[model samples]
Target: MRILLVEDNTALADGLSALLRGSGYAVDVVCDGVSAEAVTATENFDLVILDLNLPDMGGLDVLKGMRARQSKAAVLILTARGATEDRVRGLDLGADDYMSKPFDVSELEARVRVLLRRQAGLRSSAVHYGKVSLDLNSRSFSADGTPIDLPARELGLLELLFLRAGKVVSKEAIMQSLAAFDDDLSANAIEQYVSRLRRRLAPYGLTVKTARGIGYYLDRPTEPA
Candidate 1:
């Protein structure tokens, strides 16, 4: 999934960005609320990690602008304001979840999973397709009960494909879901990942088909005659 992280602390932003990317998420980071607002207005994101103590604009104002523009992206407020009133206000202003600073990274990851699942209308973290199964929480993939060791980037690509399943996912969308803000992910790199994944899943009776010039989609194996 694509996520926008709005935090001004350079160290914290770098740490969080690394953690989220390692966990198979495409992340873009901005240090101010103005940039956050502009990005949300122009681009699509599955989730937004917003900090209320932004240098330019209040985090609440950014949240309000997104809501006003009818953005459905899940918002998670991350700030040092741990007071009950602050939490209440954030929720009231359309924050889907809130976490105070100095929280554990594991807990933050768990919350992000929940919010993404909720946004995708999914109740389970394990996605099953034909003989393949992937556990997002555990970051494991298996084919016909045999464990498949996929790298982080491949796993992220598979997650996007599985989420859409039969639907055609554009190359741009795939890139957006797997590439970080500063990563130099070219189309050739994407093709390499797709080729590798296609070969890997073929043995499990799944196929990733290219839609000519459009993109790729997962074709589930049919029942035997």
Candidate 2:
């Protein structure tokens, strides 16, 4: 999934960006609130990590802009202000969760997983497709209860396809979900990833089906007649 991280602290932003990317998310960082508002308006993100102390504008106003623009991405507010009113106001303004400064990175990561899963209408951390299962917390895949190792990009592709299992996910949609702001991910690259995943999962009776001029979907192997 993709995340938009808005913070003015360069060091903190760098650390969080590295952490999220390493955990299989495409992250884009912007240092101020105006940029945050503009990017959230234009791009699609699964989650937004907003710092309320932005230099250009207040982070709450940024959240307002996002909601006004009808962006449905889950918002997690991060601020040093731990007052009850601040947390209540942010929650009232559509923030999904709030985290205070000096928080644990591990907890932040866990909350991120929960918010993303909630956004996807998923009730559990692990989702299954036929004989395959994906563990969102561990970022691991399994086939028939056995672990399967996959590169990060392929794993991301599989997650996207598996989450939207029956739907035809367009190349454009996949690119948006998998690529960072600066990354130039082409349709050809998506095709290659899909091909590799197909080969890797074929033995397990899982297939990714192409919709010809449209997109792709994950398909279960046909049953015997």
Candidate 3:
């Protein structure tokens, strides 16, 4: 999932960015609320992590602006302010969840997964797409009732494609979804994974299409049983 993180503190921002990236989330970091609004308005994001304190604009204003424009992406506020009024205002202004600062990254990640899953309409921790099913809670995949063992990275890739099934996802977008900048993408890495997935799904007649100049999409045709 792609997330826009609006944080002003240098250390915390850098740390949070690294942690989220490590978890296979495409994250864009903006230190100011104004920039957060600009980016969130233009790009499609699955989630937004906003810090109430920003250099130029208040984070509440940013949340209010998003609501004013009718953007429905899930938002989680990360702020040091612990007052009940602050929480009430943030939630009242359309923030989906609130987390205080000095937070646990692990807990943040769990919440991120929950919010993203909610967006995808996945109730259980298990997610399915095409002919393959994934146990998100267990980090495993199965096809044709047979278990398919995949490396962690490939599993991450599969999860992403499954979430956005039927839509052509771009290479740049895929790269961003995969990892942080420091883990620079390897040449033909995406192609390799797609090829592997296609081969595995061949028997099921499910397909992953490559739009040559564009990107890839997962499509499956079902027959009456």
Which has the better lDDT: candidate 1, or candidate 2? 2
Cα RMSD for predicted model 1: 1.9
- Which pairs of residues collide in model 1? none
Can you write out model 2's per-residue Cα lDDT over 79-112, one digit (the tens) per residue?
8989999999999998999999999999999999
The TM-score obtained by model 1 is 0.92
lDDT of each: 0.89, 0.92, 0.80
| Candidate numbers sorted by lDDT from highest down | 2, 1, 3
Name model 1 segments beyond 4 Å from true. 222-225
Q: After superposition, which runs of candidate 2 have C-alpha atoms over 4 Å from their true positions?
A: 222-225
Among these predictions, the greatest TM-score belongs to 2
State which candidate has the highest lDDT. Answer: 2
Candidates 1 and 2 compared by TM-score, better number:
2
Residue 113 CA displacement from its true place in model 1, Å? 1.1
